[model samples]
Target: MNPKVKTGISAAQTGLKAVKIGKKALNLKKKLPGEKKKATQKALEKSAKKAAKQEQKTEKKQSCRQRNRRALKNTKGIGRIALAIWNRYF
Candidate 1:
């Protein structure tokens, strides 16, 4: 942003600052239409990667929980069949 417009924003409302913005502007190159498509494709790829990471994280957590549950059942003298029945009904 132009410095003149930056300071004049708050001062404009009070009518105490000189507004000299919009007089001079930088000419920027317009983006190609194909550039936008590529950007969106990149964004979607990023989302898919993030989802895969989250799925792996959840899978790891579930496996850890299962291991802990098995250890608990074993410590309590619960048989495999009993554990399976308890898990199915509960």
Candidate 2:
């Protein structure tokens, strides 16, 4: 093989070996800060999702209650007329 091709193959082999050993020398950044930021972002996103779900549940409960109350109130007059008709028939 040509020297240049041989050098490239050797370099590739060395790089693959380095990868198997974790490549600690190839690191460009301190690990802690990046890890901390990633963890913080994940927690924030999780809490936001939880809060959104809680708010959705509360909204569903409130809307259902409001609808039930409105429907019952709207039927109050009909109920009274119905009762009066029943009394007259009896």
Candidate 3:
């Protein structure tokens, strides 16, 4: 695979590990007051929504990349044919 893609995968894995560790740390803490608990719940929900949006964005970008690749492939075939015709004439 591409080096950049590998690096991104590695970074994502590290981030996942950090999030897991953070959750564990949070669990170790003493119970928070009712208001604090509600605040934490809201924050977690917000973060979850943000992550979902990011995932959808990533998927859209990947689909666009695939479409661009397909377009380039089609153009490359036409380009080669044009080059052949030019070489034959000039």
Best by TM-score: 2
Clashes of 2: 0
Q: In model 1, what are the clashing residue pairs, if there are any?
A: none
Give residue 17's lDDT in candidate 3 (0 to 100).
Answer: 58
List the candidate numbers ranked by lDDT, top first: 3, 2, 1
Q: Global lDDT of each model? A: 0.53, 0.61, 0.71
Model 3 / residue 71 / CA error / Å: 1.1
Taking the tens digit of each residue's C-alpha lDDT, what string does model 1 give over 1-90? Answer: 553564455335323211211111111113336666566556655655565566557656766777798799787775767888999999
Q: Which ten residues in a row have the lowest lDDT in candidate 1?
A: 20-29
- Misplaced by over 4 Å in model 2 are 1-32
Cα misplacement distance, residue 59 of candidate 1 (Å): 1.4
* Model 3 residue 19 CA deviation in Å: 11
Instruction: State, as a TM-score between 0 and 1, how close model 2 is to the true structure.
Output: 0.55
lDDT by residue (tens digit), candidate 3, 1-90:
664685477558657855875584466344787777777766765775676567657756776787799899999999999999999998
